[model samples]
Target: MMISETLNCGAIVTTSQKGKGDLIPRAKGAAKLLRIPYVERKRLSLANLQANHKNKDILIFSQKGPQLFTGEGKAHEFHLSMAQLRLIAYDRGETDHLVEALGPEAISSFLDCTAGLGSDSLVVAYAKRSCKKMVALEGNPLLAYITNYGLRHFVHENDTVTAALRRIQVCAVRFETFLQRAKDDSFDVVYFDPMFEVPVTESPQFLSLRGHLVESGFTEAILREAKRVAKERVIVKERPFSSIFQTMEPDELLGGKYSRVAYGVYKVKG
Candidate 1:
């Protein structure tokens, strides 16, 4: 779903109470880029600000980073989530199923069709340092803006993770649009982690992102596009029971024995 369709009243960018001096200008710049109003936070609470602004969604910039607060009051921010643990496991010589499915060879370029919080892309970037080009696509402008800001600014104690975060190029474009424009065999790997038909209730980040997500279903056409663009393979991360496995019929499946999620790999024909 496009943000405009979900957020009928549109959105505004402002800073938290701690947002002052440089923060204000940065907030204004974000507002300008998003083509939304830049409202002064002043002494008003988020609730008060929403009420005054007719309940438009708020993008709050703080000294820490940018956070998106839905009119419904759910807050979305960038966090490493499972990626941190995955990176730690990688450091300990543990294998990640997604990375393993990406193949053992060094990846030259990778495309993540659904960036979400960018945890997967971050992991790929850290695990596959040989990858020279990494692009992550987020359709919603608000989510894209906050995520792009967070990827660039969020500091991690692990310098490698921080560097990996900096390496990903986040673009606010629909996956279908990006795929359509991309030339055949342009990237080594193209990946999709589409929103599950059934939500994962245990994941707070996923729940928070539920409201902002674009409901672009994974289709055969999209699969074809991904395959055409990928020189090596196109991978779709889905629930084991997802119909994509049957309909799209990946060349191979990879997952842990007890894992709920699985990766379906479609090798591009030469």
Candidate 2:
């Protein structure tokens, strides 16, 4: 999807009130990269800037990190709490459903088609130590930019987490486009975590993400492309009750019996 289509409310890049000397250049660089305008904060509040810009969304660089403020008053930033918790569990020799779905073989390359906030990708990188090449694709420009920056800079107590973050390469392109251009058997595994058809209403994070998402669905064509690109397997993450299971009819299903989510796997090669 194009930037204009995804961010129809339009967007401008700026620095936070606390951000002055150093953040200014970074904000300007982000604006240039996104092909959007850079507005001088001048100590102006986000609300005041929103009012002046006719309520367009704002991407702000600060001493803390990058944050995206939607025109509708929603704010989003990258956080590693989810991935951290999972990693902690893994350290205790617990099972991770996604990793379990990848099978017992070592993975050399992995492709994440829908890398929302990259929580899953981070876990995979850290757990699948054999995976040397990991690429994550996000269609939304705003999401792509913030996530890419966060993965590279987000500080973590565990050096393993920090190292995992650095291992992923985030690209600002739709998965369909990337998959189409990719050569056959280019990756050891191809994974998709499309936004759930039924929203997890209780989760505040999902609610916030719903507004900014580009909103793509799982389809047979995409599954075919992913299968072609993956040497070993193509996996789809979805709610257990999702209709995609009926339509796609994956070769195997991997997840706990009571788990809310499931991984549908299609083996491509032995």
The lDDT values for all models are 0.84, 0.84
lDDT of 1: 0.84
Candidate 1 Cα errors over 4 Å, as ranges: 1-9, 72-74
The digit string of per-residue lDDT tens for model 1 on 1-270 reads 122212222888889886777989989977777778999998788889989988777888887788888755367777888888889999999879999999999998999999988899999999999896989898887888777887888889988888899889888888988899899999999999998866667777766557667779999989889989999999999988889898888888999988888999999964
Task: Please list the residue runs of candidate 2 whose C-alpha ends up more than 4 Å from where it truly belongs after superposition.
Answer: 1-9, 71-74
What CA root-mean-square deviation does each model show from the true structure? 3.2, 2.9
Question: What are the per-residue Cα lDDT tens digits for candidate 2 across 20-64?
Answer: 778999899778778788999888888899899987778989787
Give the CA lDDT, 0 to 100, for residue 153 in model 1.
82
Clashing pairs in 1: 1-214, 1-215
